[model samples]
Target: MLPGNVMEIMASPSSLFSAYASFSGSMMLVRTMVNDIIPRPVQAYLWQAIRRLFKANPPVQEHLTLVVEEYFHGQNEIFDAAEIYLRSKIDANTDRLKISKSSDEGVLVSFAKDETILDTFDGVELKWKFVTVTTRRQRRVSYDEGEESQEQYFELSFDKKHKDKIIGSYVPFVIEKSSELKGKEKVLKMFTFGGYGRSWSSVDLQHPSTFDTLAMEPEQKKAVMNDLDRFLGRREFYKRVGRAWKRGYLLHGPPGTGKSSLVAAMANYLKFNVYDLQLSNIRSDSQLRELLLETGNSSILVIEDIDCSIDLPERSAPTQKDPRSELTLSGLLNFIDGLWSSCGDERIIVFTTNHVEKLDPALLRPGRMDMHIHMSYCMYHSFKLLAANYLGIPDTDDENHCHRRVFTEIKGLLAKTQVTPAEVAEELMKSEDPHVALDGLVKLLKQKKRETPADGKLETVEEIEDQLKEKVKIE
Candidate 1:
């Protein structure tokens, strides 16, 4: 009747539960009023009076007429069930409902679109209801000064879910909360609609950026290409390996060696976003873990110039630092290898350093640095690669006469000249005429030879590589 005057019927918890009582006393009382409480003579007289009133007011009679069905009948099943769940908040069949744990509780209900319930009494049951859900309750604070006549206690309590957990039109994963007091293990995943997040397993490997384009020499290029293919293939094959799904690479080489370019190539090849993590961006190791957790998958986490970015304490140094600058070496170590690393994969860790020797050994241990790639200087092969790349003329097995002659002269000079491929590429850009640059290059090599005397005054491919290797190594 007019939604049954909800304030009176539901304001009290006891009154609300009365409707669902299996052996309902109120039902019996209603029946008793119909059968015994009203005498036959008095009921007949009352019925006559009601009949006269209904004849006088047909509209009121029409409004009052309802299909008298079972206890739960002709009601909006979803809405009524939800309302009962809200106020009474109990599942009568549950053993826990028999034993009151606290003042408040919650319940979870599962239902099907079409069930046996429709066949019997409106297709719903007392069991299909919300019990007092046991969730972590957060206490909110309210403060007012000088006005003292309220229930002015120290704290106020409310359900955590009441405070808009489902943000920005996103629904939360419907998972059960733990009953225990300690922190619960949660499969918490954050997702934004149509945002750019990807899985690393889907990274494309056929792109030119997948390896250092500057690499040359049949054996060297083959190894570099194979190593890269094997790396990507192996990762794809074993997507979820070991406890941690992380893959680490250590790129070590002299400055100007294409280490950074290799990283850019990797990101471009994979189409993975490059998360260039500056050591300065992270204040401490714990913060580092948070950023790692927040970072999208299908991305590379780079710590460039690892040896020089942060003042990494030596392995034997104090493990813990004062609270002020609490990002100690141990905390970083724990994250890199401990339980935290197992959080997620779909990511790669790349550490580039010109001073690999200066890095702590612990940081470079086998599993710590999964792959070690050394980016070295221009060999005769790499020189030809630069020649072809910049000059747009084939240097090896060349049918082009001009390119072949320049390549031959340059190959001879490479024996005596210790210029970088970076330098060679630079010089090639100065003149559009490859032959003219080749002549100038030969003259420049002679000038360099006179001014910076050849280390041991002779020339051979192996000797040039060794001498240049020594110079590059020292540099």
Candidate 2:
């Protein structure tokens, strides 16, 4: 049925090869023309349509997935933010979740492993899945080290079109929202260094101290609060000025002048954790640096009784034949204001001492201790606060306050007598009735006034106690 020339071409090898070559050349030319004429979007659309035509069902969306791991080198910031941000999105539909609690914060809830959470941001729906994979490996370092561990991560998926929005806006929004939530439910922690290992352990700080309950001068309290507010609000300013975002305070006074109480109040006011570092326990500068580095940001490091903690050699001292420990005053100063100080941000350093005069001039400089607060003897204003706190006495200005008459007498004695707020608070705690407590405080003040020397100057309470102890030793 075929034509004579076509049948001859098909049967002959040379003729068939020539025909195949011509056909391939024509197909290549047609493909090149189509590629050059059609836009990539249109080509893709056509390709997808052609593929979908043969399939029973097709995927409805072009999805892009991002993996956020829990720890790479250290704890991952994005993973933490995601964990906090997604807690608000855990609806009743979520099958499982993790719940935790601290002493202060009632409860904290989060996602459990393999759980999925659906969230919408800026009208775009995103799917988040908490993934966990467990595996085993050889522990070459130590036999006690765990050979098996779980790796945790989050898989965030969304349509491919909103990649830029998810990265640029939504991710940042999540971080900001997490920060806000953290601020709202922050539970204060008290960290202390244990012997050896140079690590820190923490406990919930439940000290019932606040700015409202502290017995301090009104002006001093206001100044401290304002300074804290300014420091917190000046993160960008610190960056612009090329300085470490930190503040330092030196609290110097007698033992009973509420230095520790003041520190507690500051922690409660700013919602910052406290790291109480004892220098005597530290063996070397490296250990000190490690301890300080272990402390997190937005924390306070307190060196209490710094005068008695260690005998820091003067900078001018000559090198000895052999030093006992590598810890030096210069190293401490460096940690305070040197290059190491910039390792973290939003930090505060506090040094408390009974004798500021014993400290080196280098340690008392402006950058090292930005603010030096002298916790003086109790005054009438302080006593009023104590009265209000302990005996339920109303404000001094209240006309009907039953303690107003006693307050005037106590005010006169407090001006002449040198008594600490702690001493006064102790007196106020003796009796539940305001009148009886106020009367006892008056008697204590009169007794202290009578003991005052003729020159109207006397040794500090600590010095007098030391003298009495010496006398007892002599006896």
lDDT of each: 0.51, 0.82
Indicate which candidate wins on lDDT: 2
**What ranges in model 1 sit over 4 Å off?**
1-212, 215-218, 234-241, 443-475
After superposition, the stretches of candidate 2 with alpha carbons farther than 4 Å from their true spots are: 1-177, 321-325, 398-400, 453-475
- 248-336: candidate 1 lDDT, tens digit per residue: 78887667767766776666555555666666545656666655665555567777898887775654665555533545566667767
| Winning candidate number (TM-score) | 2
Per-residue lDDT of 186 in model 2? 65
lDDT of 2 by residue, 1-475 (tens): 9999988888999998888999999999988998999988999999898888888776678999999976544236688688878887888899998876755457767778899999999999999999977665555577664445456789999999999999999999999999998776765779876544325556668888889999887777777888889899999999998999999998888789999999999999888899999898887777787777767778899999998899877666887634445678988998999999998889999999999898888988788898888787887788888888998877667767666677778877876778999999999899998778888989999999889566778655455334333322100
TM-scores of all predicted structures? 0.50, 0.64
